[model samples]
Target: MPKDSRQGSTLWSTVLADLRTRLDAGEFTERFPSDRELVAHYGVSRHTVREAVRRLDMIERRPRVGGLVRTPPTVLRRLLDTLTALGVQTSRTTTTGEHHSVEIAGRLDRAPRTLLTVHTAVLRADGGPLICLQICSAASDSVPSELADMLLDGSDRESGQVSVVYEGTVPAAPDPEVCEALGIPTGSVTFCIEARLDLADGAPILQRAYVRPDRYPCILQFSAP
Candidate 1:
């Protein structure tokens, strides 16, 4: 039996091969050319360039609409700090609470069957909803009522020193609630990030966060290894 030669080739396949050759020859060092430049050079559509670059893992930073891209809470304890560093100010639009009465096992060393309080807020920048934050915590956590309310209106001083670790990220099609909040189309693809925040003692203070990445483009920085 012989392998089919067509199986490994595509219209964009040659583009990737050319890029790989250029990379080996030290053509790209710090950044890749813009999508427009690549399309003109490769004679392919912008979509082809995006998909090829994505498959080759040659691009990291996403195109931001504003001056700087929002760095997701991968490092900063305060998500507000992350956004501020990106040069954007956020205002909370709505806050809602969903309390699960049924006993549930807690994450990050909390007691089993602990009550969970889920607080969700839609944050805006420049008068448009930027992202939706769904934060969950153990109901026993000593969160001040005022502080909880502050999360709905603006940033607070107490929401720092918490270590945030991303648990997972997935692509999802927009639902009605998300579409309305982010003002995106009903079926647009959105990036959803789930993370856990823990106290200094390693106990979980905040269980999780759900972030909508449609409006908030992520800042991806890489260095030579």
Candidate 2:
């Protein structure tokens, strides 16, 4: 009689392949099995089970017009709303201060000598850091105070009235300040979303957001039309 002989790395690969097939078949619909359950079901060591599960975490299947397509990191307009919808408890830390800047003034279409109010926020999910956001606007009466208040409190005010000039993700190596804010290591490769939002009145709001994709993976799905 021949004995079943798969072991070690070979066994881990076999288990991973089987898990992928099961995932495609929607076997684990409600929830994924635990390590103990997987080990018992596959008759493999816990180490092998862990190795397979770790790789599975990196796999994201996105549907497209033709077929499944790879997804790139992208910006989420309503960050707090999305997280809450996903049943993740979120919290925010915001700081507002005045800064004298020429570049920010130029972006907001104000005079170069204008003062700016900088609003910085760190959004956390389940007590873990997720996004570091900064907004710059003119520190004058012309700019509506409610806009600043809404941003500071993570309200959706003026969301429908704003137009996005540019919104996308870029590979970034965050500076020491951003690294500390997002709780990521210095020199870590991450995604930064730079967006220029314009109000109906032509007032510009410059927003820069640093996102930790590993902690908060940005997955976008599209259906074929």
Top candidate on lDDT is 2
What TM-score do all the candidates reach, one by one? 0.44, 0.53
Candidate 2, lDDT over the whole model: 0.68
Tens-place lDDT digits, model 1, residues 1-225 = 112233334645767777778876867565667777777786667666666666664345446311111223342234556677788866775454645533333443556666666665676776787666555666667543343334433343234444445455556664577667777777767666555656445545443323556456676344554
Runs with alpha carbons beyond 4 Å of true place in candidate 1: 1-86, 101-114, 145-160, 165-168, 173-179, 185-188, 200-203, 206-225
lDDT of 1: 0.55
Return the top candidate by TM-score.
Answer: 2
RMSD of candidate 2 to the true fold? Answer: 14.0
Q: Which pairs of residues have clashing backbones in candidate 1? A: none
TM-score of 2: 0.53
